[model samples]
Target: MTVCAYLALGSNMGDRAEQLRQAIHKLNRRDGIRVIRISPVYETEPVGFVDQEAFLNMVIAVESDLAPEKLLETALAVEQELGRVRTVRWGPRTIDIDLLLYGDKMLQLEHLTIPHPSMTERAFVLVPLRDVWEGGALPVLNRPVDEYLRLLPQENKGVQKWGTIGWETGFDHSES
Candidate 1:
């Protein structure tokens, strides 16, 4: 069976746009994954790691035969390959990939959760998510993604579309 999943991509450590593009490529190249759609990249201010640079972010839609756990593992691997180091919570990094949703599955375990815990709270996640999912409903929330976006406070700081990039694009760092 194919599982529709949403992934949020972010980078601030190096070539932000290139890191996102490379991460997308790595995701599509995974054995059981297929890229369906990708939102235009957005530039957003740093959230948690306030001392670091802002992040270039995007969201990807994918149909995957891989299970949630395997998918999470693959995302972690991509982060590692991009030179992500877990030095601090939300610290600056070369790449950061998050599994935002996995079909309608409501997962709650030690390391994973569907409809990511903080997805709705951030404009970075909500804006790109709405771009790709506009009228689509979130698996766990059972409400349209746009509705959730509407409910949030309108304080999007520096989140705007830079341009479009794809899976086939070579991973070259594009300065943000």
Candidate 2:
């Protein structure tokens, strides 16, 4: 069976935009995973650890035959391949890929959590999430993503649209 999954991608180190594009391309090349739609990239301030550079963030929708766990594994692999280092919690990194939602299934395990625990609170996640979700109710939240986005505190939700991704704007491969 195929499941629709929403993934959140971000980067703050090195070439942020290019890292995102590469990650997406890698995912698209993976078996059982097909890129469907992608949200516009957003430049956002750091969350937990505010000392790092701003992050370029976006969300993607994919149709995949892989189970949630397998999908998470693929995401982690892509992060590692992109040279992500987890030296600090929420610290700067080359790439960060999170499995935000998986076909309305609620899951909690030792290493992963569906509906990403902090998704509701972070603008970096919610802003791009709303872009692809378009006010659709999330499985875990049972409320439209935009509703959650609106509930966030204005002062701290430092999300700003950076620009369109190459795929979204039909840019040449060389430009991406």
Candidate 3:
């Protein structure tokens, strides 16, 4: 059975948009994963460690047969393949892939947490999340993604709509 999973993508190093594009392609290319709906990119100021470059962020919903852990592995693999170096938490990155939701399942493991800890507080995550979340109420939140978005003024965080990466049909492999 295929389950829908939502993942957030961000980049602030190298070709930020290109990194996001490649990550989406790689995720879709993985077995048991299909790229479904993708949200427009949002440019936001860096959170936590605030000394980095601004980030271009977006969200994507995928249909996956892989378990949550396996899905996370796939995401990590994409990040690694994209030259993501994890030297600092919330620091500048070539690419960042975060699994925000897995169907309606809730998980709290050592390394992975479903509903992604503190996602609701981050506008960079929630702005794009509102774009792709279609369910009546956000699984466990009991409110729509937009409602959560409204609660927090993403504008205060410098979150704004950026670009709509045109990759619906397929990626132009010649360019990265």
Candidate 4:
């Protein structure tokens, strides 16, 4: 059975756009995963480890036959392939692929969490999430995601729309 899942992708190192594009294509090429839709890219200020370059962030919707844990593994594999070095908390990365939601499944595991805990708190996440999700509400949040977005303080409001990604022409990795 196929499950609909949401993934948040962000890159702060190398060619950020290309990194994100590459990650998306890699995920799309995986056997059990098919990229469904992508949110517009956003330029966001660095979060916890704030001394690094700003990040390009966005979300993607996917139809996947992989279970949630395996899906998270795939995402981590993509990050490793992209040369992501996890040295600091919320630090810079070549690419970061976070599994935001997996169908309506609520999961709590040592290495993964669904409805990614920080989704609503960060505008970088909510802005693009609102773009891809059909409605303003999310499965886990009782109130609309917009409500959380509005309450985020200005210090954390460093998110702004950048542009959309093209899936067919430039970054095609269909046969990979």
* Models, CA RMSD each: 4.6, 3.0, 2.8, 2.0
Q: Decide which is better by lDDT, 1 or 2.
A: 2
- The segments of candidate 2 whose C-alpha lies over 4 angstroms from its true place after superposition are 169-176
Assess candidate 2 and give its TM-score to the true structure: 0.93
Off by over 4 Å in 1: 156-158, 166-176
Estimated TM-score for each candidate:
0.89, 0.93, 0.92, 0.93
Model 2 lDDT, full chain set: 0.88
lDDT of 3 by residue, 1-176 (tens): 89999999999999899999889888877888888889999998898898988999999999999999999999999899999999998999999999999998999999999989989888888878888889668887788777776788645456888888787545333323
Off by over 4 Å in 3: 153-157, 169-176
- lDDT values, one for every candidate: 0.83, 0.88, 0.87, 0.88
Candidate 2 structure quality by residue, lDDT tens digits, 1-176: 99889999999999999999999988888888888889999998888889999999999988899999999999999999999999999999999999999988889999888878888988889888887884478876899877887898897688888997687743232322
| Candidates, ranked, lDDT | 2, 4, 3, 1
Tell me the tens digit of each residue's lDDT in model 4 across 1-176: 99899999999999999999899988989989988888889998898888999999999999999999999999999999999999999998999999999988888899887889878788999888888887557886666878888899978888888887676333343584
- Quote the lDDT for 8 in model 2: 97
Better by TM-score, candidate 3 or 1? 3
Tell me how candidate 4 scores on lDDT: 0.88
RMSD of 4: 2.0
Candidate 1 C-alpha lDDT tens digits along 1-176? 89889999999976788888788878777888887878888888887669989888889888899999999999999999989998989889899899999988989989998879999888889788887774477767878777777787776444777777654343322323
lDDT: worst 10-residue window of model 3: 167-176
